[model samples]
Target: MDPREGEFVDRMGLVMERFGGTRTMGRMYAWLMVCDPPHQSLTELAARLGVSKTAVSTVARQLELTGMIERVPTASREHRYQVAAGGWEHVMKVQFAALRQAVETLDLGLAAVGGDRPEQRARLEETRDFFAWTERDADDMLRRWRDSREDLDR
Candidate 1:
């Protein structure tokens, strides 16, 4: 890899680390984003990234699960991967689902706590409301984006 490319990969690694993912995951993503042909086998990824095949495989699986990357269909035994189509939109959807789940959990907590601790209950309620609002806004944003894209394509 060029020095510039290595720096970008390292920066992406830090970004992923901040989001609770391994540095390897970010590096893999960064490499895939810039690589020619936009797809690579596990062995190729490992060799280029200077990581073990096992590590590359593990991160690739995680990225696949999160809808950030996908396995390309091939007749050969070795699997290939590339960044998923609409990956950012998929990530936003995942985040919205998580926010909804958080709201549900907060509702349960509020119910269990009751009015016993007014301050805590208020805080929980506020948090739940925030999540609910954010979820609604995200849904609206996605809908608008789709609508705009359709208009542009027409």
Candidate 2:
């Protein structure tokens, strides 16, 4: 692990808190990123993060479900976890899908509400446009990210 790992984890915790996630979620995530061997057992995570095994277990499950981390194969009954392969990219894909869904749902709303009243339609249109823009931007960024990774490989 990096010498600055604790500092980084704390910073991530603060950042994640702003995003409506528990600070432990971010700290565990940051620790996973820099931890040697990458994979960690619940006990290891708890010890390093100064949290309880139960807390680690709970947060780990949440992270796994969100596609941020994944369980590693272990012969022992105790499960170990590490950051998922392409996890950041997976996060982007999930968010992109959400943005697309939001746009679609807003479109349905626009249709149901009818277009004759500009006042009523303006807010819906603007919200739809916001999500639509986000979806388009995310699509482009994903493409660029793939291209950049390809270039790195080359």
- Give per-model CA RMSD: 1.9, 2.1
TM-score of each: 0.88, 0.86
RMSD of 2: 2.1
lDDT by residue for model 2 over 45-69, one digit each (tens)?
A: 9999999999999999999998999
Which candidate ranks first by TM-score, i.e. highest?
1
For each candidate, the alpha-carbon lDDT, in order, equals 0.93, 0.91
Enumerate clash totals for all models, in the order shown: 0, 0
Q: Candidate 1: which pairs clash?
A: none
The parts of candidate 1 lying over 4 Å away from their true place are 147-154
Over the stretch 1-154, how does candidate 1's per-residue lDDT look in tens digits? Answer: 8999999998999999998889999999999999987999999999999999999999999999989999999999999999997777887898788997899999999999998899999999999999999988998999998899889999
Q: Alpha-carbon error at 148 in model 2, in Å?
A: 0.5
